[model samples]
Target: MRKWREIFGASQTDVAKIMGISPSVVSDYEKGRRTPGVKFIKRFVEALIKVDNERGWVVCKELIKSLNLNPEVIIDIRELDKPMNLDTFVTLVKGCLLTSTHSQKIIYGYTVLDSIATIQSLSGNEFWQIMGLTTERALIFTKVTTGRSPMIAVRVAPVKPAAVVLHGPKKVDPLAIILAEKEKIPLILSLASDVNELVNSLRTYARVKIIV
Candidate 1:
């Protein structure tokens, strides 16, 4: 429950208002003092759908897909100069995939974001802003050290990107690899020395549109 809350970037107050329940009840659920019944769970999911709609993101759409719930929405997809898959993306950036369930997934573009900036300023609502153009894009995280923290942020997101590229990391954290595999989001570690150069190369090659 806590994990889902964090992923949605919803506060107890937000959930309480949407659920028409008390904030203490939400906190109790997170604290494991009580468990939500099936009826409450259904309401929780419905509330999440409402939150997704308000946030202008398909996060709950993806969540519904993962659950085989068949959420229907008009997806906005775009393409770059050529189809960019995980394999080609890694090669172009001189990186390696540590974990991937779908290597053939195609992405329209890339967005280079500072990991620290995200940690500091990005709220759950702002996730769509950072993704830019569409959610079906690659998110390249700069100033990454362990690669764990940023990937954790992605895992908690309602909509997962096609792939995640971590720049300036020689080796990625094992837990980060696990999180990516669990989410089925491809995790890549780039050995690129210069973050600016790598971001520029990706933008030019992928023709990525920056929304945020």
Candidate 2:
């Protein structure tokens, strides 16, 4: 309900887009219009966990090897193992909250294995799936790591191709394009419609940031 939105800082529109349902559908769920199905429930929980790892929790510890800090943290990141002082110089995350008001997170359902899905779909992400992976990613998550926030928002509904080829998989990296526009996050694209392509795209774009 209200707690889910608060936990993820997700607006109704955002959640609806994620859920592949109308904003009205989301509203109904919020209002208890329909009982959430198992798939819906699972996605919700996953999203909640992901958001929590990004934004909440009890006081956690972080290590600063260098005096510098990156612009921000990402969901899947890599790390090196080393020894460090358990108690020493550390900075506190400002808005750290441990127990959320709710026990589950929500998922807006959408997936696509093909890049060309864009020409035929209203939401590309709805059909997109993890097309590929180069390496098992590290759990480089964020937890209330705030700072001068990135101020960028782009309304990406759908883009038209000059010509539609009904044969090949629609080659589109909707996620890459969206995240790139907003947060300068990296992305990996694929020529195929599969999870491997997605993974490869992620690996390919891991450090190549787009600055608008």
Clashes of each: 1, 33
Per-model TM against the reference: 0.58, 0.26
Worst 10 residues of 2 by lDDT: 86-95
lDDT, candidate 1, at 82? 67
RMSD of each: 14.7, 21.0
Q: What are the lDDT scores of the predictions, listed in order?
A: 0.69, 0.29
**What's the TM for model 2?**
0.26
Local error of candidate 1 at residue 45 (angstroms): 33
Candidate 2 lDDT tens digits, 84-173: 111110000011111112112211111122222222332334311111111122111111111111111112323211111111223333
